[model samples]
Each structure stands twice: as structure tokens, then as C-alpha cells.
Target: MRADARKNYDHLLAVAREVFTEQGADASLRDIARRAEVGLGTLYRHFPTREALLEALLRSSFNALAARADELQTADDSAAALMLWLRETVAFTHENRGVIAPMVSAIEDHDCALHASCVTLRAAGAALLARAQADGNARADLDGSELFDLIAALAWLREQPSHAPRSDRIFGLIADVILVRHPRPEAPNASGHTGRQPKGRS
Candidate 1:
């Protein structure tokens, strides 16, 4: 790609991320172009369709989350690492619920880049889960796709009128189910400071 074309593509992705989060999946491509300060032709040249753009957004977000897992270095406590990733995933999915809903709804009806990106994301998440399981901190039965499916389901649930609180409790439930030992639960002492403290001797 030419310098200007590369610039245009980068601009489109940045602008699209903000617009899609704010306006959901149906945010206008024309608006994206306006925000990128580029022509509609430029946006289309990089992403042929709205789904294509959404897929790119999904891929970018998933890749970012994967990088975060790497940076977390979960070898110390795979459960903690998984919990962190799960929390991030919850936040990410919550913000992108609008983008995901239509793609999920239409998946049975069409071949979509959004679906492909989701498959890839699941594979990535699965890989991380597999590693955690191998470390014996997580259950062997937890497949990556299953965990991702749960996240997607929870995200959809959160989109419902009464399911928003589920978001906070759901990930903890997931961690509880999958981890071999429940993470040291947080406790607030009489001092009013809340965190884990070393066990006192009997």
C-alpha cells in the first residue's frame, strides 16, 4: 500500500473503533470517513463492507487482548491471569455488544467476516485457557470456545433490560467453576482495608 493509503487505513481503523463503540455496529461508514477526514472511497478500499469493518475491529481487539495476556505472564498464577483476561474480555465485549449482536443474529443466514474473526478470537482465547489448564490452575474441561461462547452469551445478556448486573457476577462464576482452587477471596479487616492477608497461625 502507498503511504497515503496506509495512512488512510490506519485512520479508518482508529475512527471506526470510536464510532462503532459509541454508535454500535450500524454507525455510518460515511461518518467514519468524515471522522477520518477521508473520502468514502478510501474507507471502502480498505473495508469493502460494514461487516468487513466490524471484523477488522474484532480482530484488532482480540489481538490486543492476546497481547495483554502475554504481558500478564500468567505462569505465576494462571488463575489470576485468566481472571484478568476475563475481566478485560467482559469490558471489551460490553463495549462492542452492539457490533456483535447483528453479526451473531445473521451468522446462520450468511457467511460473514465477523464470524471468521470470532472463530479466530475463540482460538486465541482457547489457547490461553489451555495453557492455564495445563498449569493445573484451571479445569481440564474448559475449552476456549466454550469460555468465549459464555462471554458472548453474557455480553448479549448484558444487552438485555435486566441483565446488566450479570456482567459483574458472571466472570466470578466462570472463575469459580474452572479454577482448581478458588482464588484467595478478598476480605476487608476491621481496619477497613480490604485485600488478601497472610493466614494467621493457630
Candidate 2:
């Protein structure tokens, strides 16, 4: 694509994603073009159909998430990384509520799940889960898909205006259930303090 065409494509994508989130899968592509200050023909050129646009968007987001999982695998503390990643997943889901609803709705037909992109996402996320489990960090009982779906659900719930306060508690439950080791309760030290008590206390 030419420089201006590429710029228009990028702008249309950004606007479409935001509008879709606000107005759902039925959001008008024309309005997205308007927001992007581009022609309707330009939007159609970039994405021939609504489903094509949705698939492109989902693929883009998943690609970024897969890359982030690769980064987490490189970090020394795999458990901490997994935990942080879960929180980030929740936030992303919350922000992408409009995207999620339509994606789910599309899965009823045999034609759905046609993309191999979901497979790639699963592989990357599973690798991170495996690392965490191998490190004796995460509960072995929960497989990668289960853990991922659990977080995605939490993120879905997080999007509800009524559920904001429960977000922390929900994540807390995830930690409690998923973490294999609880920090040992502190023992009393020389000063007859519970180790949890300030070390400098008399």
C-alpha cells in the first residue's frame, strides 16, 4: 500500500476497534471511516467485510498478547510473571467487552473457529502456564486453557459497571487457588515478636 493508504488503514483500524468496543459488532464502518477522516472506500479496501475486520483485530490483539507471554517466559520469576499476566488479561478483556461478545456469538456455527490464530494463542499461553507449573509455582491441577478461560471470565465480569469492586477480590481468589505455596506465617524472633511484627520493634 502507498504511504497515505497505509496511514489511512491504520487510522481506520484504530477507530473501528474503539467504536466496536463502544457500539459492538454492529458498529457502522462508515462512522469509523468518518472518525478516521478517510473515505468509506478506504475502509472497505482495508477490510472487505465486517467479519474480516473483526478477525484482523482479534488476530492483532492476540499477536501482542502472545509476544507478551514470550517476555514473561524470559523473566526469572515465572510465577510472578504468570500472575501479572493474568491481571493484564483481565484488564484487556474488560476493555474489549464489545469484541468478546461478538466473538462468542460467532462460535455456534461450524464455520466458526476457522482461523488458526486461536491455536497460536493457546500455544503461547500454554507455554507460560507450563513454565509456571514446572517451577513449582502454579497449581498443577489447572491446565493452561482452564487458567486462561478463568481469567478471561474474570475480565469479562470486570467490564460490568456493577462489578468493579469485585475485581480485586476475584483476582485474589485466583491467586489463592492458583498459587502453590503460601508464604509461611512468620515465627517469633529474638524480641518475642511475631516475625511479621516490625523487625525494629522493642
Candidate 3:
């Protein structure tokens, strides 16, 4: 990394961050190069691929999130810690808009540039979930991978124009469902049954 080359890399990364924030993860690499006042070849030489560029951009944030998870492990309430981590994870994905697809893909693709970071993040969430489950706060049937999927689903909801406003509510609903202490009570039916009525009957 020569001085000039390093300067270009930094500038490109800064520009890419701006572009990605505005246009999302799938924003055009060519547009990023143009905004950075660099040639497309230069961008490719530095980033190689979209995943590589995203990996470089997200690595620090992912590391911070992993550290945060570790810190949360020592919290007094296991369920609260897990819920906090879940909220932060969902917020992180929402902040990085359009990244959920690549992240979900990266987890299973060992060769992907973002795979390691994604795996570490998932593991962090898993640890939190496991702690809660062990404390009898969270559901025992749920697993880390399922937790990751839930995060992805919530983040995806935040990405949609029609559903974004309801994302927070939906997230709360999900959190309630996951925590044993916060189970949703059955609604009373018209016939005074203390449960949901069958759809056709209703």
C-alpha cells in the first residue's frame, strides 16, 4: 500500500459508504468510483468484488457488535441481555440497509468475503440466546440459526416502504413471543372460549 494508493482506497471507501447509505448495498460500483473521482479499474483493484468492499466497510461494526454481545453476557438478566442484543442487531442491519440478503447468503457460503464476519455475528447472537434459554427465560426449542433468521426477517421488514413503520411493533411482538415470561395471552372468542376461534368459524 503506497501512500497514494492507500489514500485512494480510503477515499473510495468513504465514498462507497456514502453511496451505499443513500442507494443501499446493491448500489453500483461504477457510481461509487465516479463519486470517488477514481476509475472503475482502480475501484476493482482495491475492492475486487461487492462482497469484498462490503466486508471492508462492515468489519469494524461487526467486530464491535461481537464485543457488545460479550459484554451483554455478563448482564444480570439473561433475557434482557438477549433482547437488547436482538434490538441492536436488528438496528445494525437496518442502518446498513439492503445488507440482509448478502449477510444471509454469506453465512452459508464459506468462500464469501463476508462469511466470517456474518458467522461471528450469528454466533454472538446465539450465545445470548443460549444464555437466556439456560436461564429459562427464552424458549428452549429455538436455536441460534433461528434467531439469526428472525433478525434477518425483522431487518427485511424495516427495508420495505410499506412495512417499515410497523417494524418496531413487529419486533416487539417477536421478542414477546420468544421470551417465556412475556407470552401472548389467548384472546376470548365470541363464545367465551379463551382461545382463538377457527378462521372459518370466526
Candidate 4:
């Protein structure tokens, strides 16, 4: 890329980051171009599509999360490592608001621009979950695809204004359900009852 073209690309990416952070993943591309002081055609020339733009923006963060999973694999407690990775992955989805939809779609669509990154991320979480299950910490029936769905569900809950306050409580509930032996005891619910066991189990 020429110097000027590269400069425009960087500037557009920076502006898009800000816009997406404020308005979410579905924020208008035209707005991003306007904010970056570039023409819409220039933006399209660089990113081609909304998925392409999102892929460029999220590639680094996705890679970092994958790397974090690798590091957590060596942790002494498989359950703790899995929980930590889950928390981080959920938080990432929350941070990149409205991304879960595209991510889920990307995973099922091989030709999608974000498909590879989404697949890699899901695999990372799967590895953590598998390790915990093998250690008898998490439920054996659960799989990586289910884990990814849980992350997306948790993140979606946080996005709701009414459910945001209870997101942490729900997270604890979900975590407790996933782990065979509760890693950390959760406080009593509003009903003054301690955590409930996963359904279908004694």
C-alpha cells in the first residue's frame, strides 16, 4: 500500500473503533467514513464490506484471547483456567457490543470474512472446557459449541438494560451449572437459597 493509502486505512480504522465502541458493531459505515474525513468509496476500497471491516478490527483481539487460552492451559487448576477464560471471553463480547450475532453467523458461514477468527476463538474456549471436563471439574456432556453459545447468551444478557444489573448473578448461575464441582461458592440468591445444582442431576 502507498503511504497515503496506508495512512487513510489506519485513520479509518481508528475512527471506526471509536464509532463502533459508541454505537456498536452495526454502526453505519458512512458515519465512520465521515468521522475519518474520508469518502465512502475510500472506506469501501479499504474494507469492501461491513464484515471485512469488523474482521480487520477484531483480528488482533481475537488472536490475543486465543493466546490467553493457551497460557491458561498450563495453569495448575483446569477448572479455574476454564472459568477465567470464560469470563474473559464473555467480557470481550460485551466490550464489542453487537458482535455476537456476526460471530455466530460467521462460525456457520465458511465464506464470511470473520469466519476464521470466530472458529479459532471457539476452538480456544473448547480446549479450556475439554481440559476441565477431563479433570472432572466440568460436566462431560457439554461441548465447545455449547460453551460458545453460553458466552454469546451471557453477553447478550448484559446488553439488555433490564438484565445488565443481574448479569453477574446470571453468570455465576451459569458457571455453577457448568462446573461439576462448584469452583467458588456463590452467595445466596434473593430467595435466600444457595446455588442450585444443574438440572437433571441429584
Candidate 5:
């Protein structure tokens, strides 16, 4: 595209992100064009559909997240790396709150432009989960897709009109439960006693 066209495209995306975040995924395309100082034809020329525009807006974030997971896989502490990734994922979701609602449906709709990106995003999370599980950090029963849904749900909760700022605390607790190792049952000693012994006694 020409320099001027590229400028308009970028401007449209920035304006769309703001408008969508404020007004949700159903924000008017006409308003987006007005804010970007562009014509409806121009908006359509650059992004033929709302899904296309959303996909373009989110593609970079997803790519960065996937890359981060790849880097974290090589980190010395697998569990810590996964927790960090989970925090980043929550932040990403919070930043793109407007997209979360539609994204849930889009993820199931094979025809949506954002579906493929969501799939790739899930795969990245799955890789991190697998690494943590292999290290005996995360639970073995759940997979990346399930964790992704939980993250999305947390984001949705953040979007609701709540007076208390509890998302971070709740997210941390969730990460602890999902990624940390579960406590094992106590075993009997040689004397066949399961109760705890005195501190001074072995």
C-alpha cells in the first residue's frame, strides 16, 4: 500500500481499539470512521469486516504472547515461567476486554477471522502448561484450552462494573491453584502413626 494508505490503516486500528474498548465489540463502524477521519469506503477497503479488523488488531498481541511462551519454556524454573505467562495472559485479556465477548463466540465459529489466531494462542498456552506439568508443577488433568477459557473468564469479570479491585488477587489465587503442585496425603511412619510428632522428637 502507499504511504498515505498505510497511515490511514494504522490510524483506523488505533481509533477502533479505543472505541471498541469503550463501547464494546458492537461499536458503530461509522463512529470509528468518523474518529479516524476516514470515509466508510476507506474503512471497508482496509478491513472488509469487523472480524477482519479485530483479527488485525489482535494478531500482534497473540504473536507476542506465543513468542513469550517459547522463551519461557527455556527458563530455568518451569513453574515460575508458567505463572509469569499466566499473569501476562491476564493482562493481555484485560487490555482487550472488548474483544473477549465476541472472541468467545468467534473461537467456536470456524468462519471467523479471529478463530485461527485464537487456536494458535491456545496452542502456545498449552505448550507452557505441558512444560509445567512435565516438571510436576501444574495439574495434569487440565490442558491449555481449559486454562485459556479461565483467563478469558477472569478478563470478563474485570470488565464488569465492580467497586472492588479484586481481579489481580483472584487471578493470583487461580494461578496458584492451577499451576502449583497439590499437597500430598500424609503417610504413616515406621511405627504406623500418621499424626505429627513433637518438634523435639524425630
Candidate 6:
């Protein structure tokens, strides 16, 4: 690419990231061009579609996430490391609103520029999940693919107007189910009650 063309490309990417982070992956392409002080044709020349732009924006983040997963794989607590990575992934989705759909769609599209990055991200999480299960810190029945599905579902829920205001409580509920341990009954109190008294008698 010519020096001037490379400059435009860099500027467009920077502006697109800001616009998408603020207004989501579906933010106006024209706005991106205007913000970058470029023409719509130039934006299209660099990124033909919203998906293309989003794929470009997310490629770097996906690479970084995979790198983080690598570091976390060696952490002392496998389960904790997996949970931390999941939280980070959730934050990424939250910041890049309207991106989850395209990401999910692109994962299976070989032609999509984001496909390789998406697969790498999933593979990184899968390794962590396997490690946690092998260490007996997490349920063995669940797999990394299910974990990805769960994350995608949660992201979609968070993006919806009705669920936009949800908190960590929702994530806690799902994580509890996925990461539960054998429940030991509580010890009886002095009254020999296991906290099973009727509501009216309590």
C-alpha cells in the first residue's frame, strides 16, 4: 500500500474502533468515515461491510485474549483462572455491543476474516476448561463448547433492551451451575434445626 493509503487505513481503523466501542458493531459506517475525515468510498475500500470492519477491530482483541488465556493456564488455580478469563470475555462483549452476533456467525464461516481469530479464542478457553476439569476443580461433564455457548447467550441477553440493566448476579447463577461442588449439608444448630423450620414458625 502507498504511504498515504496506509495512513488512511490506520486512521480508519482507529476511528472505527472508537465508534464501534461507543455505539456498537452496527454503528454507522458513514459516521466512521466522517470521524476519520475520509470519504464513504474510502471506508468501503478498506472495509467493505460492517462485518469486515468489526472483524478487523476484533482481531487484535481476540489475539490479546488468547495470549491472556495462555498466561492464565499456568496460574495456581485452574478454575479461578478459567472464571477470570470468562469474566474478561464478558467484558469484551459488553464493551463491543452488537458484536456478539457477528462473532457467533463468523465462527463457522470459513470465508470470514474473523473465523480464525474466533476459533483461536475458543481453543484457548477450551484448554483452560480441560485443565480445570483435569485438576478436579470443575465439572467434568461440561466442555468448552458449552461454555462458549453460555457466554454467547449471556452476551445476547445483556445486549437486549429488556436485559441491558442486568448485573453480575445473572452470571453468578450460570457460573454456579457450571462450577458447583458437592454440597455438604449444614451442621445442625443447638436446637438440632437444620434451618428447615416452617416459614410461619421461624
Q: Tens-digit lDDT track for model 2 on 1-202?
A: 8998788777777888889888876788888888888888878888887767887777767788778888899999988898887777666666666555544444333355424555555567678889989999888888866775776578677777798788899888878788788577778799888856456787
Q: Which candidate, 3 or 6, has the higher TM-score? A: 3
lDDT of 1 at 95: 78
Clashes of each: 0, 0, 0, 0, 0, 0
Per-residue lDDT tens digits of candidate 4, residues 93-195?
A: 9999999999999999999999999999999999999999988999999999999999989999999999999999998999999998755777999888787
TM-scores of the models, in the order given: 0.67, 0.71, 0.88, 0.88, 0.81, 0.83
Question: Which model is ahead, 1 or 4, in terms of lDDT?
Answer: 4
Clashing pairs in 3: none
Instruction: Give the alpha carbon lDDT tens digit for every residue of 37-134 in model 5.
Output: 88999999999989899899889988999899999999998888888888888788777766777777777899988899888888888999899899
Residue 53, model 2: lDDT of 82
- How much lDDT does each candidate structure score? 0.75, 0.75, 0.94, 0.94, 0.85, 0.86
Q: Which regions in candidate 6 have their CA more than 4 angstroms from the true location?
A: 182-202
Off by over 4 Å in 3: 182-202
In model 2, state the lDDT of residue 192: 83
Model 4 earns a TM-score of 0.88
Task: Give candidate 5 regions above 4 Å deviation.
Answer: 2-4, 21-24, 182-202
Candidate 2: count the clashes.
0
Q: Global CA lDDT of candidate 1, please?
A: 0.75
RMSD of 4: 7.6
